[model samples]
Every structure is written in C-alpha cells, then in structure tokens.
Target: MIEKIGFPLVLFAMLAIVLVETNIMTSGIIITIGLNLALALVLTQILALLYGFSKSLKILNKTRRHPLYSPAREASVNAQLRSLKK
Candidate 1:
C-alpha cells in the first residue's frame, strides 16, 4: 500500500519542481494542485482497500454457510469405522 501511493507522490513532487523551475507555474498553484492530487490518490487507495475487504467478507460468509459434513461424507466415515471394527 505504501509503495502504491509513495511512488506516485514522489513523481508528482518531481514534476512540481520541474514545472516551478521552468516558470510554467507559480509556487502557490503548484502546491494546491499537488495537494489535491495527493488527496485524490489517497481516496482512491482507500476505496480499493474497502472493495477488497468487502469481497473477502463475502467469501468468508459463503464458506461459513456451506456445510462441511454432507450425507456422503458421513456414510464414508461410517463405512471406514465399520471396516476398522471388522
């Protein structure tokens, strides 16, 4: 997660520096844009994390509702027990 946001933030900072050096934008404007971009990136990361968490919860619920022991499994176990007794 850190790598996902950190790399892009580093690139944005470098770009802001270059833009400022080239006189393409003022410091205040660059700062504002950089902050907004960072906010957007962080929000996107949070949304992605939430989406993944929801998916995991859904899978967990499905597994919990599924029966671990069915009739066939019970029969198999009983057969093994009988064979052992014999």
Candidate 2:
C-alpha cells in the first residue's frame, strides 16, 4: 500500500513543482503545500498506529466470538502477552 500510495504522492508533488515553475503558483506556495502534505502524512501515520493500538486493546477485552476478532488482532495480542512475560 505504501508503494502504491508513494508513487502517486511523488507524482503530484512533481506536478505541483512544475506548475510553480510555469508561473502558475506564487513563491513559497509550493513549498508550503509540500510541507503541509508531509505533515499530513506524518499525522496520518501516527493516527493509524493509535487506531491499531486501540483496536488491539479492544480485541484483548473481548471473547473469541466477537465479530471484530481477526487473525492480525490475535497476533498483536499474543505479541503483547509475550512482551509482558519478559
């Protein structure tokens, strides 16, 4: 997914830079846009991690028959158990 998303992001950034060079954008606007996008990506990643952690915690508190019981969730719970054991 990162590979899929990264190509399009790079393409868009390059396109924006090209537009700026063509006088279609004002000075500092391109850089500001790029910085904002970068910050958004960073925050998105943080938010995803937080969501994953919350989901994992929820799974830990539920029984096996819970609809949200996924293999990945189980794996995360097991990893947490092992870490706690150490």
TM-score of each: 0.47, 0.47
> Which regions of candidate 1 are displaced past 4 Å?
1-10, 13-26, 68-86
Clash number by candidate, in order: 0, 0
Predicted candidate 2 versus true structure: per-residue lDDT over 1-86, tens digit per residue: 98998988866667766766687774677666864676677798899999999999887677666786788987998899999999
Candidates' lDDT values, in order?
0.78, 0.77
> Candidate 2: which pairs clash?
none
> Candidate 2: which stretches are off by over 4 Å?
1-6, 10-27, 64-86
Best by lDDT: 1
